[model samples]
Target: MDDGAERIFAALRDVSQSGAPLYLQLKKNIEEAVKRGLIGPGDALPSERDIAAQADISRVTVRKAVQDLVKSGVLVQRHGSGTFVAPRMERVEQSLSRLTSFTEDMARRGMAARSQWLDRGIYTASPDEMMVLGLSASELVSRLSRLRIADETPLAIERATISASVLPDPHEVTSSLYMALGKTGHRPVRAVQRISAVNLGEAEAQLLAVPIGSACLQIERISYLASGKVIEFTKSIYRGDAYDFVAELRLPGPDGQEGEAT
Candidate 1:
């Protein structure tokens, strides 16, 4: 093992005297090391067997700890290659007031964005769909699924559902769904989105070129037009290692700030 790995093992052993679960202890130690700059982003980590030998722990314990780190976005595993520290993600700037598309976002970042159409068709609404999209039983729903790419890297899988009456034809839609909707006078003016974390499954891992059970960002978004019409609802899974969502907070102007409650 290298110097960094040796230090990691020693620190973990020293901090684990309280006898916490081995895997959790290892995780905590590594996180602290990262925070303290002993480990930096994009550093290569020791292999499982190497770490096990260095720490005098079982290989299973090492595996569990490494896998947990991979699932939490702290590490990344490359197929046919070894695991490494995850790259730092650039914060994504989103205007909470406007409905935007992945292509548009990438363009603003000065990267070429692309999408592979997976499945597209019209279907009747299910009970869950009716609640999510505010659709009626008789209304036709269009589902568009795509694998999103930016700068030639696969970044996310997106599925969009909307009223067929709004889109009319699915094939006419291309790169940016928002742009397409704008052309039809049904552009979304506002949206509500919920964000969460998930572990990538085998299929998603294959598509995103990450290890199975890797961390991902799950976002569900519902957009509305000014007429109180539900324009579209979308669910997206973003590669956790490659994306960061950010929100900027501002203090109130001087007088209001002074009167703010603690």
Candidate 2:
């Protein structure tokens, strides 16, 4: 067995006992190794077969233990690559009560934000776009698609559509789309967002440097101006392990008063 397998065995020996399932004991052994600094982030773990042999446990148990760690974000598996300790990432907390751009959100946390543009141009509004943006069949819309990065780590894939009247040239948006719209007095002041969980597909997984089928948060947002005109329609996928969305709630008053406190 290799050094990593040997270490795993040693850790397993230290914690192995009767009564509990072997897989659970192995899982605890791995966690303890990580806590004691025996295994650090990005360190490759022993293969399932190797771990099973060294720990004298069934391969099925080893596999289950590893999979559980993956689901818990304690480990990461790369396609054609062995499992490894997950890289430590700073989780970003986003407030559901604010209408802020991704750039603005990162800026608030003093993190540098950048984008890799994938698509930018005007296209005939699709039926869905037309319905959402209140555009006619003949009207065109500007589309901007990009991979958003924070501190050089890929965080999200964002595709935003705006009325051509609001943004004549998508290419003009070199950084923040909201900033570009502000110049034309079409920046949205409010937005409604719906969030759901999805498994990353191959293309998006590759772009985000995550394994295929990794969990992610998919968000669809419609931004509106003070006049209630839809200014932007956006769809975004954020890394599940790297973001937290928070919302503050207030208790109702004696008379059942609710809504933002005055």
Candidate 3:
């Protein structure tokens, strides 16, 4: 490393030992440095190895710190080059358990919903998909891949798989698939969903305006009709910063009466 780089690394390390987690402290130190004119926006960051050696911390810590900044749109990583600060943008989030469409959810919050359709097509089903929708191998399924937005802020990317027998025309779906299903007497009254945390890939981060490899929420939902038939299966990725899923629970009363209060 050059003298300038070594000095920069030492200064960053000194700033990082302030009782905060190493990664967060590193991020804050760099941002403060930039704000104070120590580094400009387009300036390249010290390599992870270089930062680790100077900081006397693990390379993993440096990588995590850089990745967090990237996810926050504070840093940008150029393949085969290095990491630098990112330009500004907005980030959006949606609750995973809401049984509403992107439009409806956003509207309730006084935001407008928009979509960029990545895919809309019909194809033969995967075994898991077929089993979930109760379709045969010969049956067709419609797939809709969309980036959902509110007030032009990307919230999530949803890839919904539907049984063609349930929804033969994808064009008829203008907004919420849930509402469309209700119109056709196939609306799901209940659903089972799973949630997991993961890091975003380059494509997802670019589309959602988050840093590549940033933490996100992955949700998989299977919604069922009143008759207990699965009507739809959807997979969505939500920005971790902006979303929180809450549920209200109840149990039978002491008198053996079922709880009824909402």
Candidate 1, residue 262: how far the Cα is off, in Å: 14
Candidate 3 whole-model C-alpha lDDT, 0 to 1: 0.79
Clashing pairs in 2: none
Write the residue-wise lDDT of candidate 1 on 1-262 in tens digits: 5787766666666434467988888888777877787777767787788777766778898889888777656777767788776666554555644456888888888988999899888888778778877877898888899999876467899999888988768877878888989998988988888999999998888677677888989999988899987788889998887787775456576666634333
What is the RMSD, in Å, between candidate 1 and the native fold over all Cα? 8.0
Better of 1 and 2 by lDDT: 2
Could you arrange the candidates by TM-score from highest to lowest? 2, 3, 1
Query: Considering summed lDDT, which 10 consecutive residues are worst modelled in model 1?
Result: 253-262
TM for candidate 1 is: 0.62
Instruction: Please give, for residues 1-262, the per-residue lDDT of candidate 3 as tens digits.
Output: 6655654675686744558898778878777776776666566788888788878778898888888777667677767888875543344444544576667777787777888899888889999899889998999998888999766457789999999988888767878887888898988888889999999999998877787787889999898888999988999998876677777656778798878665
TM-scores, all candidates, are 0.62, 0.68, 0.64
Instruction: List the lowest-lDDT window of 10 residues for candidate 3.
Output: 87-96
Clashing pairs in 1: none
What's the CA error at residue 30 for candidate 3, in Å? Answer: 12
lDDT of 2 by residue, 156-182 (tens): 999999988878889999999999998
